[model samples]
Each structure stands twice: as C-alpha cells, then as structure tokens.
Target chain A: MTGALIAGIAAGLLAAVLHFAFVQSYILLGEQYETGELVHFQTPADHATEDHAAADQHDHGSHEHGDEPSVLQRNALTVGFTVLLYVAYGMLLTAGFAIASQFGRKITATEGALWGLAGFVAFQMAPGMGLAPELPGSAAADLTARQIWWWSTVVATGGGLALLAYGRSILTVVAGIVLLALPHVIGAPLLDAYYGYAPTEVGAIFSSRVLGVGLAVWVVLGWLAGRQWDRGAAA
Target chain B: MTTTTQTKTQSLLAPILGMAVIGLTVLLAVGHAQSATLHDAAHDMRHATGFPCH
Candidate 1:
C-alpha cells in the first residue's frame, strides 16, 4: 500500500534522526578507541604510550582499507543508509500487517506499537541475546558464521512470534514456541580468545544504547505504519 | 474494511513477497554485505543499530 511506503519513509527518517541524536557519539568514541586514539585497561606500571597495544586483532573480513574514512564528514551516507534500513523494516512490517488484515484480523494504530515491539523482539532482541552489539576493534566470531546465526535467529523469532500472535490452536502455538527457542538453544558463535581495543566500559554502554535506540525507533515505525494502514481501512 | 480498501488491495501474497524481498535486500546490503565500501559507508549505522560489525 502507498500507506506503508509513506510510513516506511517517515519512519526511516525518524530513525536516522534518533540515531544521530542518541547513538552517533558513542560510535565516534568507539572508533577513536578502535584506531588507537584512546586506550583501555591500562595500568600506570605498564603505561605504554604510543604503543598500538590494542593493535586491533579484530578480524574484519574484507574490511581492508588503504585510508581511514574521515569522521563526521559523511553525514549523507549515514543518513541515506539508515533511511534505507528503516524503509526495509517498514516494508517488512506492513507486509506482515497486510497479511494479517487479509486473514480478518484488523490492526489499529495503538496495536501497531505492540507490533513494533514484536519486531524488536524478532529482529533486535532475539539476535542480540546471541550477538551483543560490537564496537570497532572488538573481537567477534567469524563474520560468515555470525551472519548465518543472526539471520536464522531473526527469521525463527519472527515466524515464532507470528504464530503465537495469530494462531488459535494449541498445536500452532506449540510450534511457535519451538521456533522461538531453537536459535538460543543452538547458541551464537563466539570468539575463542577475547581481545579488543575498545574499553569494556565503552562497549557496555554502546551495546545497551544500541538496543534502546532500536526499541524506540521500531515502535515509532510500527505506529506510523499502522496508522496509515488504519487510515486506508477507514477510507 | 471498506469497499475502497478491498479494491485498493489485491491478493496479499504478491505484495507480501514483493515487499519482503525488497526489504530483505535493503537490510542485507546495509547490515550484512561483506564489501569494504559498504562497511565503510555504513560504519556508523552498522555499529549504532547493533548489526554484527568489526
């Protein structure tokens, strides 16, 4: 529907705004630590200045770079990519909404907030339990392995939640529960040895804030999409 | 639902699949693609949104 498209665009812009306001600074700080500008866990006895002690054993596959990108200069790319991300989320959200509506389940603007939370659960919370947000220079499991786990977890959680939300019979609900639990049971791939350039303190803050921002943005997205869908229904 | 609503929407399958494919592509490109250019281009968002990043 045009409603969902408009909603998606609106939500994407809002999400980017929220990201700029609340999330960008921490990313900048993490990058500083990532590039040897700041050091963490240093003690006076072994205070090693000018030592790239945190030499970024980070295995960012295919992230080789000849020169570092200038910080704060590429606002256009950041905003553009973020909008694209949320637009995608919006499309997916409304697609689910349309299917539910077709099945005789009507969605309201208020109910859409719940859908947003569900989206967060499926997309952000579920996968996050396995792979907490990471900072630059932080050690992570293999790229391909983690991606596979993350994508699977999102699909499983979304499908499971959908069943629980829409299912009437016990059997369907039970199947939903199974899908929800499958990924966590398998566990996310993690690094065997942990080494990182960023401080644990910064990492901790950044991770939680990412989730927090995700929650807010997703709720708004759902609400906007739902409102538009409802308007179409009323018309 | 109104008659207008019914007329405006078609079989749900087509739209659902269409949107799902497009949305997934955008998400994958922004969040998971392995290209160095994409990673650099989306560095802030990649980190801010909790997608797995270096």
Candidate 2:
C-alpha cells in the first residue's frame, strides 16, 4: 500500500511534467481564443476593438503591474495544478491496480500502459465522444445534466473494461459490453443546436490534442506506477 | 481462520474505499466548489481534457 501510494505520487509528478511540457501551450492557446484574444472563422475587424478592451481589462485584473507573471510563476502554477490533479488520478489508478493484483496478475509496465490506455478511454475518450471538449465561451447543456452523464459514462466504461479484460465467462463479457454501450444508448444531453463562440475547427483540434495528451500521460502513469508497485512488492 | 478472512476482506476493501472517497472529493471540488481558485483550476482541467464547460 505504501509502495502504491509512493508510486502514485511519483507517476503523478512525472505526468504533470509531461503535461506542462506538451499540453499546457495548447490549452493556453484555446483560452486565448475562448477569451477573444484571437478570432477564427470570423473577421478580426468585427470584434477587434471590443476584444482589445476586454483583453485590457483582463490584463489589468490578472497582471496588474504591466508585468506578466514570470515564466517561473506560470510554470509552477501549471505544474502544481497538474500534479495536484494527477496525484488524485494516480492514487485511484494505483488502488485499482492493487485490486487487480489480488487476482494473481503480475503487475508489469506493459500491463500498466494498457491499464492507462483503458483509463484514458474511460475517463476522457468515452465521455468526449458525446460531450467533446469545449472552449471557454462555448455553449453547453445544463451543468448538472452534463456532470451526471459524464460521471455515469466513466463509471460504466471503467467497470465494463475491467470485466472485459478479466472476466472468464461469456456472460461477464456480454455484461461488460452492455455496460459500455448503455451510456451512448442513453446518450449525453445535448443542446437543440450547436452554438459556440470559438470556431468548430478550433474546438475539434482542442478536443483531439487534449485526448492525445491524456493518452500519453496515462501510459506513463500506468507504467511508472506498476513498476514501482512491483518493486515494492519484491522488496 | 475467520480473523484471517476478515483481514483479507478489509485489506481489499480499504483501497477501494480510499479511491472512492478521494474520487468523490475531487468530483465535488471540481464540480461544485465555491472557491473561484479551485473552480478555475478544475475548469481549466475540464477544458484541457476536452470535457465540456460553457
């Protein structure tokens, strides 16, 4: 247990580092678009002045001294937030791994990577199929409804994958498949029509890139956590 | 034997419980926290992961 916890912390930190290095810039870019700093699929002339005024207000509020946050401060906050979130993620992953290990499976880095991929599929890709990623100012369904759907999908997918991967009987596999499909069958709540301030293409790119980064982080997290757990067990 | 079985069960239960507690705390914090800082951090993450946020 101690080993698993330690492994989780380490993996979370590393995944945060990877996120900072590869994923943060895209997010920042999307935020800029979301907040109207940059315009796409629309003429700049339409909103240029309004955007600048908004930007000026934002700048004053966020960076009052006319000096932007130092690179160090920005990186620290990004890394700190990523680490905080990933640590929770890592702990859960590690715990799940522990449960799996009870079934006589040997924990290995490759297996960890596979588990990570499953996690990415369950938590991000599956929900994303319905919700997709949204930029800051994009239109969305009711928050309560979306959250409920997202959580249910994650639970169903995760549980389903676990059964599919480990279940010995055909019945179990079938049940797993059903659980996996049930969410989509019910479908996520959607607005009557698509509405958003950002361009569709920007949202698409943001969604895909976020998923890509999630995949990489999960793989690394799983590999490292598994290796650590195994080593701790051996010790 | 009963004691050993009970111990084993507890061992298995502990991690799952821990995960559930932590996961729910995060979900609540990210979804409904009153603090802007917590909300913003989680909001950024939601966007980062492509989870929908208006």
Candidate 3:
C-alpha cells in the first residue's frame, strides 16, 4: 500500500511535468508561425463587425498575466485539485496495468508509449484536422485551414506509428485514445458557432505538428508513469 | 498460513472494490442528475489545468 501510494505520487508528478513540456513546445511553435509571418493574425480588431473592446481586453489580460499566482490566490486549493487529477489519472492506469498483468500479460514502458501515440493519432491528430479548436494565439496566422488539418493528421498518424513500431500493444494505445477523448466528450460545446467552418489545410497541418509533439511527450510520460508504478509495486 | 493469506487478499480487494463502487455510484448519479453542469465544470477545470485535449 505504501508502495502504491509512492508510485502514484511519482507517476502523477512525472505526467504533469511532461504535460508542461508539451504546452511549452506548442507555445513556442505558435510564436514561430506568428513572428515569421507564415500566418496572418486575424483578430476582432481587424474586422469592423466584431467588438474591439472585448478583443482588446482579452489580449491585454493574456499578455499581462503573471507566472506566479497573486496573494489572494487559492494556492492550496489549486495544488490539491491538481494533485487529485494527477493521482486519479495515475491510479486508473496503474489499476488497468495490474488487472492486465493478472492475465499473464506484461506491459512495459514502451507499450505505454505506444498507447500515447495512439491517443495523438485518434484524438488530437484525426479530430484536429477538422474538429479541434484553434488557439486564440494563432487566430491571425495566415495558414489555410485545410493545410493545418492535413498536416495535423499526418503528424498524428505518423508519430503514432513510430511509437507503435517500438514494441507496443493495443490496450495502452486504446486507453490513451480514450483518455484524450473523454474530457472533450464531456465538456465544451460540441459545435461552437465560433469555429463552425472546417479548417484550411495549412491550419490543419500546423495544428497536427503541434499535437504530434504533444503526443510524443505524452507517450514518454505514460511510459515513465508505468515504469514508476511497477517499481513501487515491487518495492 | 492459508487463513492468513486469505485475510490479506480480502483486505486488498476490499478497498479496491469499495472505492470503485463509490466512484461508479457517484459517476452514475452525476450522469443522471446534472450531466451538462458536470461537463461544463469538468471542461473548465481541464482548461485551467492546461490539459492539452481541448
């Protein structure tokens, strides 16, 4: 029991860290497209029909946001909730592995990585081409929507295949996909008036690359998590 | 020794099943009672936590 708890904590931390890495990479890539003028920034400011005040307010707040929380921040509450999310996700995976192991099956970190890849291909890659939401930061970029979709699909499928080729299996792959999709299925308007139209190929491509990188990060994280869980059980 | 092994096994299974039951019950009740509200909150939480799925 002690071992399980320790393992759970370790897995949670590792996954969280990996998630941070993916976010940073996506952010950086987005900056590249913006600064390079590869994509035009389209804002409500550019359109006379939209509310400039709302757009300006949004931009100002985002640009001025601090890395550290304010004194009035619910730091403890945030940490507690974050920890709960991580531990719960970890526990679910660990339990799944444990159950699988009882069936004379063995899963390794590599297998976990493959599962992560599948998640990218199915949830991020496939949907991203047409279904994923574009980031506000990339709103003004000049890339076409179809281009973005295609690129995203290529990255997702290709990256997933690369991960699977390294000796992974079906279970983790499927689990990762399910994990990626669950929150989406449960939240946000499925059909938002904001992104009603299909994305251009360029937009899809850009989104795919970003998502591919994210998938890679997730695969590594999941593998590390699984390895840590196994170590805890043995210890 | 056999009885001891059985007791240990029972102890482990007990908590696992208990927690699972609790989780499932809450999940089902939430699903039936206020799915939209639950979804909205979960979505907001996921975004705040920087979950990449969205």
Candidate 1 per-residue lDDT, tens place, A1-235, comes to 6776787778778878887666666666666677776667668644553233223212121223447554335667888888888888888888888878878888888878789999999989999899998877688998899889999999999999989988999998999999999999999998888988877776787788889889988999899989988998889
Best-matching candidate per lDDT = 1
DockQ leaderboard ranking = 1, 2, 3
Error of 1 at B33 (Å): 1.4
Better of 1 and 2 by DockQ: 1
Candidates by TM-score, descending order? 1, 2, 3
Sorted by lDDT (best first), the order is: 1, 2, 3
TM-score for candidate 2, please give it: 0.81
Q: Highest DockQ, which number?
A: 1
Q: Write the per-residue lDDT of candidate 2 for residues A133-202, one digit (tens) a residue.
A: 7766567899779888998999999999999999999999999999999999999999998756666655
Error of 3 at A33 (Å): 18
User: A65, model 1: CA deviation in Å?
Assistant: 15
In model 3, the runs with Cα more than 4 Å from the true position are: A1-83, A111-214, B1-12, B15-45, B48-54
Model 1 clashing residue pairs (backbone): none
